[model samples]
Target: MSVEAWTTVLVILSFIVYIYIGWRSRVSDTKGFFVAEQGVPAVANGAATAADWMSAASFISMAGLISFLGYDGSIYLIGWTGGYVLLALLLAPYLRKFGKYTVPDFVGDRYYSNVARSVAVVAAIFVSMTYVAGQMRGVGIVFSRFLQVDVSTGVVIGMVIVAFFAILGGMKGITWTQVAQYCVLIVAYLIPAFAISMLLTGIFVPQLGFTFGDIVEKLNAVQVDLGFAEYSQPFANKSMLDVLFITIALMVGTAGLPHVIVRFYTVPNVRAARYSAGWALLFIAILYTTAPAIASFARYNLIDSLHNKTVAEVQQLDWATKWENTGLLQFEDKNGDGRFQLTPEEASNEIIVDRDIIVLANPEVAQLAPWVVALVAAGGLAAALSTASGLLLVISSSIAHDVYYRMVNPHASEAKRLMVGRVMVGFAIAIAGYFGINPPGFVAQVVAFAFGLAAASFFPVIILGIFDKRTNKEGAIAGMITGLAFTIFYIVGVKFAGMPTWFFNVSAEGIGTVGMILNFVVTLVVSRLTPPPPADIQALVEELRDPTHHVPIALTDIGEEQLD
Candidate 1:
C-alpha cells in the first residue's frame, strides 16, 4: 500500500484506541478528572508520565534541532534530563505527600492565601498554552505531509481529537491513553532508528555503534567539504554562556512544569510517586539516547542527498517534493548555477529547510519501507496529541478547579465543576489551535519559551514553599509576579519587539535563568521583610521535608485542623 493509505489506517487505528480508552476511563467526579483518583500503579503511571513529558518537543523537534545545530543541540538533552532529576529528587515526593490535586492547590494551601493560588493558576495556563501551541504545530506538520492537508486543517483535526478524550475522561482518560501512546511512539521512534542504523553503518545498535568509529569521521569530513563546520564542533553558532543559560532554563523549567508535576499526584503515595518517577526516567532515556544517533544519521543523509543537486533533480525524489509541498523545505539558485549548494554563509546558501521537518522526513530520506514512513507519521501525531491532551487538561483544571471552584464558588457541585472544566477545554482548544496555525516560532523554540516561563514563574516559588518554613504568601506572590513579568517582557521584546540581547548577551531562550535568579532573590528578600507563614503551615513544611517521613504526610489532618 501507499504511504498515505498506511498512515490513514495506522493513525485511524491509533485514534480509535485512544478514543476507546478515553471512554473506558471516563470520570465524572473532580478527583478522578483532576488526578486519576490517586490510584494509578507506579509502572503504568510512569509510562504515562513519560508520554506526557516527551511531547512533540522530544519526538519531532529534538532530533531536528540536533541535526541542524550539531553539538549545540546536546544542551536540550542535558537540560531536560537534569530537570527531571531535580523534580524527582527534590519536588515529587514532597508534593505527592502534600496530597494536592494541582500545583495551584498546593500553592494555595501551603501559602494560606487564595491570592497565591490565583497567581499560580494564571502562570500554569500561560505556560501550558505556550507549550500546547508547539504540540498542535507538530500535528499540523505531520498531517500536512502524510494526509496531504494544509497545516490549519491538520491543527483543527488534532484539536478535535484531543478535546474528545480530555473533555470526557479528564486525567483518568489521559493517563491510560498516554500509556498506549508511549508504546506507539517508542516503537515508532526505535524501529526507524534500527533500520537506518543498519542501512548506514551496518550495525543495529544505534547508541553503541552509531557511526561508532569511522562513520563519524566520514560524516564530519563531508560537512567540512561543504563549507560547513565539522558536525561535532562546539559553539558553532551560539556562545558558551548562552548554552549554559539555556540548559539551566530548560532544567528548572522541567522541574516547575505543572502537567509533569501533576503526574506524581496520580500515584497512590509518595513511594509510588518516587518509583514512577524513576521508571519514567528510564523510559525517557530510551528515546533520548537514540536521538543523537538519529541526528548524526539524518545530518549525513541530508548533506549527501542535496548538497550539489539541482531543484529539478531533487524534485524527482518523492520525499523532497512532498516536504516541499508543506512549504518547510525551499531552495533558491542565487548564482543561477541551476544547482543547490550547501554553504556556511546565508547569502549564498541555496536551501532553506525548516529544522522541524528533519525527523518526520528522516525515514523517507533514507528510503525506508512505506510502512516505516507512515508509522513515523503516526508516531509524530501520537507524541503531539499525548502532550497536547495533558496540557489542555492542565489549562482547564487550573481554571475550573483552582479559580472557579476553590476561589469563586466554594459551593459548586461536582457536576457543575466537571461541566465548567469541559467548557474550558473547548475554549483552550480553540486558542491552542489558533496559535498552532500562527506559531511565533518553530516547535522546539516555542517549547523552549514555555519552559523558560515555567522556570521563571513556578520553580522558585515551589522550591521555597517546600523547603523554607519562613516563606510567606507575600513573598511568593511578589516573587511569581516579578519573575514572570520580567521573563515575558524580555522574551517578547527580544523575540517579537526586536529588543537587543542586553543582559550579558543572553538570548531570549536563556533569559529564563536570569528570571529564576531574580525570583529567588526577590522571594528571599520579601520573606525576610514580611511576617512568616502561620505556625501550622510551617509545621506542615517541616514535616514533609523530614528525612525519615516516608509515609504519607497526613495533609487531611492538617486541612481539617487549620487549612479550612
Candidate 2:
C-alpha cells in the first residue's frame, strides 16, 4: 500500500476504536462524565494520564526542539519526567484521598470559601485554553501534511471527532480512549525513533544509542566538518544560568498543571494514585528517551541530505516540495550557488523553517518505508486530538460545574448543568481553533507561559491547602492573587520590556523559575501572617490524609446530595 493508504487505514482504525470505547462507556450522569465515578484501575488510569500528559508538545514538537537546541532540550526531558516524582510523593495521593471531582472543589471546601474555588476556576480555564490551542494547531499541522488537506479543514475534522467522543464518553469515555491513544502514539513515536537509531548507531535502544561512543565520535566529526558546534556537546551560546532556570521552571510547572493533577482524582485510592504516577512515568519515559534519538538522527540526516544538494535536486525531492508547500520548509540559494549549503552561513539568514517539522519529516529524510511515515502521521493526530478533548472537558467543567453550578445557581438541575457544559465546550473549541489557526508565536513557548501561570497561581495554593493546617482562606486567596499578579507582570515585562539586563542575571530561561519562587514565597509569607484555618478546615485536611476512611462509590450509586 502507498504511504497515504496506510495512513488512512491507521487513522480510520484509530477513530473506530476510540468511538467504540466511547460508546461502550457512555455516561448518563454527571459523576460518570466528570470523574469516571472514581472506578478507574491504577494501571488504566496511569495509561490515560500518560496520554493526557503527552500533548502535541511532547508527541509533535519536543524532538524537533531538541534537534535544533541540542543539550538545552534535556531540560524538557528531565523536567517533565522528574515531575512525576513530585506527584507521586507529594500531591497525587493526598488529592486522591481528598475524593474530589475537580481541583477547585478541594480548594473551595478546604478553604471554606467559594472565592478560593473561583480563583482556581479562573486559573484552570486560562491554563486549559492556552494548552488546548496548541493541541488544535498540532492537529491542523498533521492533517495538512499527511492527509493532504488544508489546516482549516483538518481543524474542523478534529473538532467534530473530539466533540463526539467527549460529549458521549465524558471522563469515562475519555479515560479508556486515552489509554488506547497512549498505545498508538507511543508506538508511532518509538518505531521511527528505533529505526533511525539502529540505522545511525546500530543500536535498538535509543537511550543507549545516544550514549554509544562510536556514534558520538562520528557525530562530533560531522559537526566539526560542518563548522557547527560538536553534536555530542552542549551549545556554546547557551548560558549555564539559563539552563538552570529553565529546568527549574519546567519542573515546577509540570507539578502545577491541573489536568495532570486531576488524573490522580480518578484512581481509587492513595496507593493507586502513587502507583499510577509510576505507571505514567514509565509510559512517558518510552517517548522521552526515544525523542532525543529522533532528534539526533533527524538532525544528522537533514544536514547530510541537504549538505551539497543543488536547489533543483532538493526541489525534486518529494518531502522537500511537500513541506515547502505547507510553508514549513524553505530554502534560499545564498551566495548565488546552485548547490544548497547547510553550513552556518546558510542556517543563519534563510527563511524560518518550523522546528515542529523535524518529526513529521524524519522518515522521508531517512528514505524509510512509507508505512512508517504514515504511522507517524496517525500518531501526531492521536496526540493532538486526545489532548484537545481532555483540555476542552476541563475548560467546560470549570465554567459549568465550578462557575455556574457552585456560584451562579446552586440549585441548577442536572440536565441544565449538563447542557451548559456542552455549550461551553462548543464555545471554547471555536475560540481555541481560531487561535490555533493564527498562532501568536511558537506553540511550545505559549505552552510554557501557561505552565508558568499554573506554577505561579495554583500549585502553591493546592499544596498548602493539603499539607498545612494553618493555611486559612485569607492566606490562600492572598497568595493566589499575589503570585498570579507578580508572575503575569514579570512575563509581560520580559516579553515587552526586554529583561532588566541585571535581575538575578539568570538566563532568560529562568523566567518561570523566578515566577514559581515568587509564588512559593508569597504563599508562605501570607500563610504565616494570617490566622489558622477553621477547625472544620483542619478536619478536612485530616480526612484527606486517611485514605482508608473513604470508600469508592460508583457514579450510578452516588446521590446528588453526596456530591454537594
Candidate 3:
C-alpha cells in the first residue's frame, strides 16, 4: 500500500478503537467523568499516565531536539524520566492517600481556605492550556505531513477526535483510550528506532549503545570530517554555568508539572500510586531510550546524504521539496554557493527545521518502506491526540468541578454541573485549536514554558501541603505568588528584554531552576513566619497519610465529603 493509504487506515482504525473504548466505558455521572470512579488498577492507570505524560513533545520532538543539540539533549531524557522518581517518592502516594479529584481540592481542604483553592485553579488552567497548545500543534504537523492536509484542518480534526472521547467517557473513556494510545504510540516510536539502531550500532538497547561505544566513535569521526566539535562531547563554546542551569531548570520543571502530578489522583491507594509511578517510568523508558538512537541515526543519515551536495541537487530530490513545502525541512545556500552545507553553522541558521519532524523523517533516512513511514505518522498523531485528550480533561475538570461547582453554583445539580463541563470542553478545544493553527513559536519551546510555569507555581504548594503540617494558607498563597511572579519576570525579561548584565548571570537556559529555588525559599520563609495551620487542617493531614482510613467506593458513590 502507499504511505498515504497506510496512514489513512491507521488513523481510521485508531479513531475507531478510541470511540469503541469510549462507548464501552461511558459513564452517566460526574464521578466517572473525573476520576474514573477511582477503580483504575495500578497497571492500567500506569499506562494511562504514561500516555498522558508523554505528549507530542516526548514522542515527536525530543529526538529532533536531541539530534541537533547532541549530548545536551540528555537533559530532557534524564530530567523528564527522573521526575517519576521524585513523584514516586515525594508526591504521588500522599496525594492518592488524600483522595481528591484535583490538585485544587487538596490545597483548598489542606489549607482550609477557598482563596487557596482559587489560586490552584488559576495555576492549573494556565499550565494545562499552555501544555495543550503544544499537543494541538503536534497534531496539526502530523496531519499536514502524512494526511496531506493543511495544518489548520489537521488541528480541527484532532480537536474533534479529542473532544469526542473526552466528552463521551470523561476520565473513564480517556483512561482506557490512553492505554490503547500508549500501545500504538510506543510501538510506532520504537519500531523504526529499533531498525535504525540495529543498522547503526548493532546494539539492541538504544540508550546504552548510543552513549557507550560505536555511535560515539562515528559521531567523533563525523565531527572531525565536518570541521565541527566532536558530537560525543558537550558544546565547547557554551559555559559550564549554562549547562548547569539548563539541567537544573529542566529537572525542577519536570518535578513541577501539574498534569503529571494529577495523574496520581486516578489510583485507589498510596501503594497503588507508588506502583503506578514505576509502571509509568517503565512505559516512558521504552520511548525515552529509543529517542537518542533515532537522533543519532537521523543526524548520521542527514549528514551523509547532504554532505557536500548542492542545494539544487538536494532540492531535485522528492523528499527535499516535499519537506520544504511543509515548512519542516529547509535548505539555504550560504556563501552564495548553490550547495547546501550540512555544517553546524548551516543547521543553526535562523530558518528552523521543525523539531517534531525528526521522528517522522527517520524512517525515510533509513530507506525503510513507505509503510513504516506511514506507521510513524500515525504514531505521531496518536501521541499528540492522547496527550491533548488528557489536557482537555484537566481543563474541563478545573472549570466544572473547581470553578463552576465550588464557586459559581455551590448547590448545582450533578447533571447541571456535568453539562457545564461538557460545554467548557468545547470552548477549551476551540481556543487551543486556534493557537495550534497560528502557533506563536516553536512547539518544544512553548512546552518548555509550560513546564517552567508549573515548576514555579504548583510544585512548591503541593510539596508543602503534603510534607509540612505547619504551612498555613497565608504561606501557600505567598509562596505561589512569589514563585510565579519571579518565574514570569525572569522568563519575560530574558526572552524579551535580554538577560540583565547583573542578574545571577547563570545561563538563562535554566531560569526555571532559579524560579523553583525562589519558590521553595519563599514558601519556607513564609511558613516559618506565619502561625501554624488550624487544628482541623492538621487533622486533614493525618487523614491523608492513611489509605486504610476510608473505604474505596465507585466513583458514582462518592459523596461531597469524599470529593471535598
Q: Name the runs in model 1 displaced over 4 angstroms.
A: 547-564
Q: Compute the lDDT of residue 46 as modeled in candidate 3.
A: 89
**Clashes per prediction?**
0, 0, 2
**How well does each candidate superpose onto the true structure, as a TM-score?**
0.98, 0.93, 0.92
Model 2 weakest 10-residue run by lDDT: 553-562
lDDT of candidate model 1 versus the reference: 0.92
Off by over 4 Å in 3: 208-213, 235-238, 346-352, 496-509, 546-564
Per-residue alpha-carbon lDDT of model 2 for 1-564, expressed as tens digits?
Answer: 877788888899999999999899998777778888878999999899999989888888888887777777777787777766776678877777767777777777777777888988888887788788888888888888877888787788888888888888888889999999999999899888888888888888877898772665676688788777876577454677777777666677778787888788777777788888889888888888788878888888888877778877887888888887777787777667677666655544343468888898899899889999999998888888888888888888888888898779979998888888878888888988887787645556666677777777777887887778778777777777776776666666776677563556654345766766676677678878887765656776776666566653222222333232
User: For residues 1-564, could you state the per-residue lDDT of candidate 3 as single tens digits?
Assistant: 877788899889988999999889888899888888878888998899999888898888888888877877777787777776777777877776676788777777676667777888887787788788999999999888877788889999999899888888988899999999999899888788777777787776666667664876787699778777776577564556666666666666666666676677777776787888889988888888778878888888777766668766776766556667787777666565666666556444423467778888788777777878888887888888888887888888888998888767989998998898888888889989988887655576667777777778878788888778888888888877787777777766776687682456654446666777788888788888988876766766766665576532222322335232
Which one is best on TM-score? 1
Candidate 3 weakest lDDT stretch, 10 residues: 551-560
What's the lDDT for candidate 2?
0.78
Better of 1 and 3 by TM-score: 1
Residue pairs with backbone overlap in model 1: none
What TM-score number comes out for model 2?
A: 0.93
Model 1 misses residue 42 by how many Å?
0.6
